[model samples]
Target: MSASTHIAVVGLGYVGLPLAMALAEHYPTIGYDLNEKRIRALRQHQDHTQEVTAEQLKNSALELTNNCQDLVRANVYIMTVPTPVDSNHTPDLSPLLTASEAIGGLLKQGDVVIYESTVYPGATEGICADTLEQASGLKLNQDFYLGYSPERINPGDKVNTLQTIVKVVAGSTSETADFINGIYQKIIPAGTHIAPSIEVAEAAKAIENTQRDINIAFMNELSMMFHEMNIDVLDVIAAASTKWNFLPFKPGLVGGHCIGVDPYYLIHQSQQHGYFPQLITTARRLNENMSSYVSERILKLMALHSKHIVKSRILILGVTFKENCPDLRNTRVVEIKDQLERYHARVDICDPWADSTDLKQEYGIELTQNPRADSYDLVILAVAHDCFKEDAYTPQNFSREDGLVFDLKGLLPKNEVNARL
Candidate 1:
C-alpha cells in the first residue's frame, strides 16, 4: 500500500460527506456529487444535510467537486452512492452503476475502486466490477483492483461514528484486501475487520441491516398483536427486556437508506439464485405495511374521539425518515399522510429537522411553519425528533383538548397519548 494516495469519494450524501472528511486527514481526498447545489453548499462551509458541521468543513482539507474531471487526479475511488429500490420495490442500482461508470472512465492501471454502498452479495464483482471493466477496459485484479468496504454510517447518531465503528474491508485479491485495510485503519480508531473475501464483505453488510429489519419486523408484528389485545407493546417489551436474552427491538416505520431498503437487495439476490428467502421476504412485507397499520390505528383513534375523518385537521410531528436527521430516502411517514388524505383529512406536517424546501420537492409535502395551538383534531408524533420529546411540544399544546394523540414512537407519556404503537 502506498502512503501517497489520492482518494475520491463518489456521491457526497450522508455517508460520503463524513467519510470524505475523515479520509482527508490521512490522504488527499476529494468528495464528488452530481448535485451542483450540494457542492456549492459544501464549498460555502454550509452542510444542509447537517452531517458535517461548519467548523469541521472549514478545518478539513477535503476537496469538494461536482465535476467528473476533478476526480482524474485520484488513484483510489470509493463509491458511496445510494442503492435505493424502485417504485416496484426492486433494487435500483442505477445510481451505484452510474457512479461506477463515471469513476471507471478515470481508472488507471493500478488505481483501486472501492465500494461503500449497501448492496447484495457479489454486486461489486458481478455487477459494478463488470461496469468498471466495460468503461475503462481494465481487468480486475490485473489492471485495476476492486475493494468492498460496506458503509456503516448511522445517520442522526452522535455515537457509533466512522472512527468508532469497526470497519469491514475486503477486496478481489488478498494483496488488494490488505491495501484497503491499511487505507481505512488510518482513520478508524475502533480498528478494522478484514473479511476473507469481498462477497463476505457484501453479505456482512446486507445481513447487518436485514437482521435488524427482521428483528424490528418481529417487534412490529408483536405490537399489532398486542394492540388488538388492548395491551401496550412497550410495557410488554419492558417486562421482556428484564431477561438477559431478550432483544429490545421497538416497533416503528422501517424506512431509510439501509434497514428498510437493504433487505430487499438481499431478497432480490436470493430470489435470483432460486431461493425465495421466505423469512426475510415476509419481514420486509410486514415492515412495509406498518405505515398503513399506523394510519388505520390513527383513524380508529379519531373515531373513538368522535372526530370525523373527512375534512379533519391532523398534525404530524416530524417528516424526515428518522429523528434528528434530514436524510429522507424512503420514509414511510409520507405514506401515513397519504393514507389519511385519501379519507379527505387535511394533514399538516411539522418537522424542525427537515428542510421545508426538500419536503415540498421530494415528497410534495409542505411543512407547517406555524402549527396552530390546540387546533388539530388529531396529532400524530410520527418521528420522535428530540425537540418533539420536550415538554413544551407535548400533545396537549398542538391537538384539541379532546383530540386523538397517536404516539407512534412511544415518546409521549401513556396518559398523554390516545394510543401508541
Candidate 2:
C-alpha cells in the first residue's frame, strides 16, 4: 500500500460506492461507472442506492467519472460490477466481462485488477483473465496481475460495513495476493484473509450465500409442511432454536442480489463439470416457488373469508427484495404480485424505501405513496422494513373487519395476524 497508489473502482453501485469511499481515505481513488446519470448523481452526493449517505459522499475525496479516459490515471482497477443471472437463471458474465475488457485497455505494466463481483469458481482466472489478455495483448503475471475479493455487502445494513467486514483476498500469484491483501488491510478494520487461490475465494463467497439459500429453502419447505398441519413455522423455529446448535432460519421470499442469484452461479459451474447438484438445485427451486405458494395461500385465506379473488383489493406492504433497502434488483416480491394478479386481484404495493418511478419501470407496478386506511380485503407484509414495524403502519389500520393479514416475514404479533408463513 503506497500513498501513490491511484486506485479506480469500476461500477459505483451498492458495493463500489462504499469501497471507493473507504479507499479514497487512504489513496487517490476514482469511482467509475458507465452510467452517466449515476456519475452525475454521485457528483451531487445523491446515492440512490443509499449505501453511502450524502454527508459521506460530500466529505469523501473519491473522484466520480463515467468516462474511460479518466481510468488511465489509476494503475490499480478494482471492479465492483454486478454478475447477475440471466432470464434462464444462467450466469450472466456480461458486466464482469465488460469491466475486464475496459480495464484491460487501460492496464499498465505491474498494474493490478481485483474483482469484487460474485462469480463462480475459475471465472476470474478463466473468463476475465482470458478477456484481459486478448484485449490488452498483455500476458497475465508478466504484464499485469489479477485478484479476486468477492463483495459481502448487505443492502440496508448499517452495521458490518466494508471497513468492519473481513475481506478475503486471492490472486493469480502469491505476490499478487499479498499486494491485494495489503491494499485492503489498510482500510478494513476486521482485516484480510489471504486465500490459497483465487478459485478458493470465489468458491467460499459462492457457498456463503448458497448455504443460506439452502437453509432458508428448508425453512420455507417446513413452513409449507407445517401450514398443512395447522402449525406456525416461526413458533416451531423459536422452540427449535432453544437447542444450542439449531440454525434459526425463517421462511419468506428468498430474493435479493446474492442469496437468490449466487446459488445458480454455482449450479451452472457444477453442471458444466458434468455433475448435477441435487440439494442446491432443490433448494433454489423451493425458494423460487415460495412466492407462488404464498399467493395460493393468500387466495385460500380469502376464499375462507368468503371473499371473491377476482375483485378483491390486496395491499402489499413491501416490494424490495429485503427489508429497509431501496435495492430493487432481482426481487421475488414481484412474483407474488404477478401470481396474485393472475387471479385478477387488485394489487397495490407500498414501500417507503423503494423508488416509485423505478418500481413502475422495473416491475410495471405503481407504488402507492400511502396505503388507504381500512380499505382492503387482504394485506400482505412481504418485507419487514423498519417503517412497516412502526405503530403507524399496523395491519389492522389497513384491513377491513373480514380482511385477512398474511405475515410473510412473521414480523407481526401472532395474535394480531390471521396467519403467517
lDDT (Cα atoms) of all candidates against the true structure: 0.90, 0.91
- Per-candidate clashes, comma-separated: 0, 0
Q: How do all models score by TM-score?
A: 0.98, 0.98
lDDT of 1 by residue, 25-118 (tens): 9899999999999999999999987878999999999999999999999999999998989988899999989888888899988999999999
TM-score of model 1 relative to the true fold? 0.98
Model 2 quality (TM-score): 0.98
Backbone clashes, candidate 1: 0
Tens digit of lDDT per residue, candidate 2, span 1-421?
2336899999989999999999999999998999998999889989999998899999999998999889999989999998899889999999889889888888888888999999999999998999999889998989889999999989889997888899999999999898888899999999999999999999999999999999999999999999999988899999999999999999888888999999999999999999999999999999988888998898888888788999789999988999888989989888888888888989999888899988988878889988899999999999999778787687778998878898988887898898898
Model 1 pairs whose backbones collide: none
Q: Model 1: which ten-residue window has the lowest total lDDT? A: 388-397
Clashing pairs in 2: none
RMSD of 2: 1.2
> What are the runs in model 2 whose C-alpha is more than 4 Å off?
1-3
